[model samples]
Target: MPCGAQAQIIGYDQPDAEGGEGAAQAEPYKPSKRAGRGKGSRRLVVQPYIEVNQVVTAELSPGDDVLTYTEVAAGIDAGISGQRNAVSASVRYERRIGWSDRASDGDAISGIVRGYATVVPGVTIEAGGLATQVNVENGGSALAGGLFDGDSRTNVYSIYGGPSVATRAGDVNINANYRAGFTKVEHSDAFVATPGGAASDVFDKSVVQVADVEAGVAPYDVLPVGLAVAGSFYQEDISNLDQRVRDMQARAMVTVPVSRTVQAVGAIGYEDVEISSRDALRDADGDPVVGSNGRFVTDKSAPRQIAYDVDGLIWDVAVMWRPSRRTSLSAHVGRRYGTTSYGGTLAYAPNDRSQFSVSVYDNVAGFGGHLNRLIDELPDDFEAVRDPITGDLRGCVSSLEGSNCLAGALGSVRSATFRAPGIAASYSRRIGLMNAGIGAGYDRRKFIAAEGTILASANGVIDENYWLAAYISGALGRDAGWSANAYANWLSSSDPLVGDVSGYGVTAAYYRLLTQRLRATAAVGIDGATRDDPAINDIWTASALVGLRYNF
Candidate 1:
């Protein structure tokens, strides 16, 4: 099965996996406006505590292949502090012993077992997670997750279970959510990735994508003008691309009851994109190629893709004014007029905390995205997964239609929209009885990119670029017991189709409550980040952790 490669099995007759084929589901990856590794609040006390850490650094990390002595659970106490929401879960796995993508070499196993539901005041729900990832004989380049080689390496089977529903309707607040899932890839043969970039092609069946979702919403009382509606969807089917997606959003507000405090807000959305196919082809070493039957095109194989039929629709609108209680004014407009995308964001708030804002965006009118070079070199190495018959770079003319692509950097992104302006503020009081808060923000952006190397008959690489960022956060103590928190962030980019990155880090933590079910805790942090975007990239990293707990 590894002597020359040849096995085809890619399915998707409308079985979407956010790969496209709409109805709903495709938006629930919002865990990172902050949270790469943040352990800000802690509480535990009832008995038993043991947690440890040591991952001094990683010079070249290509998206977590961890466990070089990753030191696990170590132990656990109970829970209580920061208002005890006691629940626990653990389960893990992995294994990759060589060329795990130019050498991250790995075999990985994920772990999570859950049970936590004690943050009571009125309404609270607890949910846990479980996962499993494998790479036993990985030679890398399964077309970077489009999967063409799913056995003897790269087998990620996952199971996510859940239960979450917070309550409060009288005061205006409600919540509900659900997640269901499955991912399987087994190939005794069949892999493809080579159109000029010799070597690196394997596919023996894969293309089933689905990540589930269910939702409910309610929130309204004014303040910033609140009222929201929700819907979600997701799917997965490696290589052959059995995709799925679905989305829904809603909003409304009013306080300008003729200046009764000055408030007016609005929101609107509609999304539908579909793509289904189970007659897949891209057997390469065996030549099944086919995508619209033009003799194979679309970055030329191994998930480079070129099969479209995901209906599209997107829209947005906004307005706000609070002419002084302290001071306030806002304006925002957004739209994807089906690929004519527009943009907006502007703000000012004088009190009730503090505020300032300015922004412009239009992620490629139609959200046009057909990326490669491993998602623009995600951390490094993978000219379409190596050896593609000698580093093909997607059947080049130097991509971007060859000629070294770079199409005048798409005129530095003039109309595709992507502008930036920002300002933000936050404040909280209770210095003596303890309980404080502080925040800051800054933004700047201008970009429209699409360089090359995914085979457009070669030619056309280096689209457009420009970017910038800044951030900060703080916390104090005493809402009932103890507290402390801190944060920092910075980012950069000025073209090269967006490259150049920045980094900053800081964190602190502590909490206590020893009775009513016992609660006690402790924490510490020092994080890191740095990105140059592209070309001769540079890297610097850091990490640290500590733990102790017990409660309820």
Candidate 2:
């Protein structure tokens, strides 16, 4: 996909991509009504294609030899759209064959699917799943995938779905949802290293469940501001570690129209959080260590819980402005996660052909909490599309899918229940036939294991991550095109058990229309990573490909 299409696939609400940011401002919750009769058989379409590429791998570190390989891949995509239902899905399979005896053959399967339907007048059903590889240093891509090997990639997949109901009680809008999902980490290990440099890999796997409920009543409309009382409850359960967390809040919310192009929202409330988990900690000799306080002595090298339960006051305030069709600014500041938290987004379109955005975020969450947030933001029934490359949902607000377009541009993430804060910025522009985009961001997270019950310890630690990405594409003519992308990422953790690492990669490709339904392509890419710890080796790999794709 082109840079512009990449932005659209990820659901970024850019000025030229989606008519502008005016389509992204927040709106009061309201029950969705059944769709009326419409024309055209709910738009439905299907596409299938096949491709082949020759790849070569090169290592920059000592004692490694260069290797070459060939890969064959095929995929299919389908989408549905209409007044009452929306759906999108795709699947791809690739096989890598090596020419050298030292290199092993492998295969990968990846895709994403999401859809929603109004089952009845006030009820909606929705589900979504993402299957992709996780790179050791750069996380993973939802579309154009990263390199895969024992050193750089692991398979991970997440799937979730549920039913939701929205109804009006007088002027109050009530909404509730119940969703269950599983996050599977296969053929992977969480390597733990002690202070002494001894390391071990423990299999990491788990199941997740989430539920939420909220209701709000708008009582006044005569003033420039509107008032509403809202209450919400959210809970998450992680089966592998036998952990559960809950959050509840009740707040008075106000929405103000500062002017024709400016708006503000404020909320104040009481919030509470609770967590529970099983206790099990052991010493080097395999003996349980008990603290003087009669709890298990937590180990710094192992997962430890924190007493995060909080019951207190919380407030949030935000403002949004679109002074012109080419510019937008929105920001929120508040007390959350038992701490002061803030986030914001700024978007500017200097002309008809370019758009830019920046975003900042801070929050505390339970296991699978991020996934829950994605599900919660979805409307009862809405039209949506996933990035054709990464297979990630574009978003849930109008065609924008909420402010999450910002998150998608920055790159998605994975974390155990924890508190995190981060910021990212991205810009995309098209000059004549050439298009480009760039993005960068950083994040820090403190994990929560278990609190008090033998799991609480003073050894709590945090993980920090930084990343940058860029892409450029241009047309050679109506029948031919070319594109290139580059990305880099670094990760560091306070815990001695986790290693610090950095990685960089680049890819370039050119293609031409061979026939009405066929195209020819050539591409090359590089992947490299290095670990700060001497025990972990540094490596580099490269690949090139020539392929023919047939589409129908």
Candidate 3:
């Protein structure tokens, strides 16, 4: 029910608490929960809503065209909660068919499903899936922050499911799980050629299959705090590209209480990872190049296909402190992903009415695979449809397809890997009938080349990026409200084709209750981006819309 105008800020760091992928979500003011509300023994709730909007858009730059269009959207939401089971789902479809120009017209279907079932007292089955398409920067998408048609778009879909079991053997608590999943990424056709000369559509597609299993056991009463040992193995097979990766890890973990208000955890482990790809060499005329070994020669100059393996001792330590009931601090340091990494989180409540948090992290991952892992960690709450820190929806959550999905998936495409490290902080509070928040962060991404990529080069594609954002929302009255958000992003890449770039976005929305189940809305948004690359021209875009929604 919390839908409104949204703007993605361009930034140098990961804008979310986890320092993960995707743009940040605006932290709108949240009203306090009404008092005396109680949960029903067994509850099921369903609602349906529809909206129609007339939008007008304008562009900056010479020979630009102004445009107008109508958007129609409909969706349903449902949730069921019981003593041993929980399920929630939402589905929505939207269409925008321009009255004149059809270049930017299309339809989108997005949804999420999450459920958990307890077959026995100590065993559970969990499943979920999500699909979404949105205009975003990076990831081989059409709407990238470049000079060409700035109205680009990308679509992503994924599904995963699995079962978990936990039981006690004497004083040891044991748990295990298995998961499988699939993911697909697609983008609109290119409006212009990339630096490598291939169309944007080449980096536009990928399909991956993932599977993994993990187990752990701990004997808490035997030690001051607790101790455990865990191990996991995962594999990934990619299509539309030639890449296969296998990974495994085993570790001994322990937690200890330092004081009444402080605690710490540490882990020591060994990891084994293997990455391989098929990159066939071709003759000048495009025929396969024969090698002395009677096998196709791998074209290393195009993209390295030789198998690469890395494994070593791994360890990490983390500490958590809660000096007071309303404040907490946590810090983590580890060595993983072929590098040393660290992260921490701090949360404080200045008063009963306001809260602030800061977080920082560093890690490396396959981009597409990391996105799936993020989805795997989503909360089961029905309204937790989108990432609160980053505006990205849980696109791939099909529980039916795999368990512990995303355990081995890598990069959104099979063409590259990313070592991402970043930090972010934000504060939010409510005063009377109004709520507001502000946040900022910086992220640096280093792309490592992979096989079967059509990109000119991967190492310098998307480099340092940073951003800042602010938003405010307040209740107009008992049944009305208004909100506004603004953000700016800057990018500096080593890639000549995508030099320094900057962008900004602003959006505002107001809604009025027409009835108990109906509402009217109006919104306006402006977004623009510029690049220092001489070959690319700067572009700006604006849009305004009026619409209505009804809830069942």
Per-residue lDDT tens digits for candidate 1, residues 1-552, read: 000000000000110112223212211111011111112246443343332322222233334332222232322223332333433333322232332353344333433323333334432332322232222221111211111122433433333333334445564444433333332333233222344332111222222221222122212343433444433333323342222222222322222222433334343445443323232344557544444422222232334233233334443444334333333233444443234433333333343333333333332111111111001101100011111111111110110000111111111211111222233333333334443434343433332212222122111222232222121223333322433333333433332233333333333344444445443434333333345445443333233323223322
Off by over 4 Å in 2: 1-45, 78-80, 87-90, 118-124, 137-145, 163-179, 194-224, 281-306, 322-328, 347-354, 371-416, 430-435, 451-459, 534-536
Measured by TM-score, the strongest candidate is 2
Model 3 gets an lDDT of 0.53
Candidate 3 or 1, higher lDDT = 3
Q: How high is each candidate's TM-score?
A: 0.23, 0.75, 0.73
Question: What local distance difference test score does each model get?
Answer: 0.27, 0.55, 0.53
lDDT string for model 3 (441-476, tens) is: 666666654434432255445666566666667798
| C-alpha root-mean-square deviation, each candidate | 24.2, 7.5, 9.9
For model 3, give the 10-residue run with minimal summed lDDT: 2-11
Higher-scoring candidate on TM-score, 1 or 2: 2
Scored against the true structure, residue 366 in model 1 reaches a CA lDDT of: 10
The total of clashing pairs for model 2 equals: 9
Angstrom error of the Cα, residue 438, model 1: value is 49
**lDDT leaderboard ranking:** 2, 3, 1
In candidate 1, position 468 carries an lDDT of 21
1-552: candidate 2 lDDT, tens digit per residue: 001001001011122223444544434422121121122237777788886766666665654677777778788877777766777666778787889787678887776666677687667676776666655332221212354455545565667777767776766666655566666545333232233222222213345444444456532434445666655555666543345666777777677766656667787888887765554456687655544432233344554354468889988887767666557676777887777777776767677576666667665554245443444333232222222222222221122222222223212233245666777666666678876666667767666655434323312556676777676678998999987777676777665555677767777788899998899888777767777879777767666667777997
Top candidate by lDDT: 2
